[model samples]
Target: MQAKEAAEKLGITQRMLRHYENEGLIEIDRSENGYRRYSESDLRRAGRIRDFIATGFSTREIKSMSACLSDEGAGPCEGGVIKMQEKLEHIERLQADLDARKQAVLDRIEELKQGLAAEPLEL
Candidate 1:
């Protein structure tokens, strides 16, 4: 497959595919005429990269994860695991903060309602 065809299949722009190649995420073999040749493995890798990107992983992180996942008998790379754990912790903190904010907003609305009910109008 060609770069354009692969990118279309992956639902990404050609430039994004090239950018991933440039970032060492995926590679393409070159023909004698210097045209890029993509194999089935490359398409599978592109799908993995696209999925990771959609999940908020940066290109560099995706590249690292892919390399780790490719290792044989590595018994599961700990780096990606640690990174995901950290992200999960961060998300938990953000959720706690959001819940607090929501409570504050509810309290403020109740206070406003009470004040409005207590006001007397002469007109």
Candidate 2:
């Protein structure tokens, strides 16, 4: 499959696919004419990378865990495990911060509601 078709199948832009290739996330083949020829495995790998990106993982983070992604249950890779743990910890900290912000917003909304209820003044 070509870059266009593979990107379409992966539900991502062609530029994004190229960027992934450039980031060394997925390896792509070149045709005789020098066009990219993406294979099933490549697309599969792209999908995985896309999913990780959607989950807020950066290319560096994904690259660091590339070893585990390709391992076919051949035991565990310590580097991959450490990278994955770091990613999870980063996500957890972000989530905690976001939750705090959301709670602050909710409290402000409640305060606004109380003030409005006290006096329904003209706009």
- The per-model lDDT (C-alpha) reads 0.79, 0.83
Over 4 Å off, model 1: 31-35, 69-75
What is the Å distance of residue 60 in model 2 from its true position?
1.3
Clashing pairs in 2: none
lDDT of 2 by residue, 44-115 (tens): 778878977897789988887786555351247557566667778998999999999999999999999999
Residue pairs with colliding backbones in model 1 are: none
lDDT of 1 by residue, 1-123 (tens): 888898899899988888888998877898889988888878777777787788667887776677543423134565767766776787789899999999999999999999999999769
TM for every model, in the order presented, reads 0.67, 0.74
Clashes of 1: 0
lDDT of 1: 0.79
lDDT of 2: 0.83
TM-score of 1: 0.67
Q: How displaced is residue 38 in candidate 1, in Å?
A: 2.4
lDDT of 2 at 115: 91
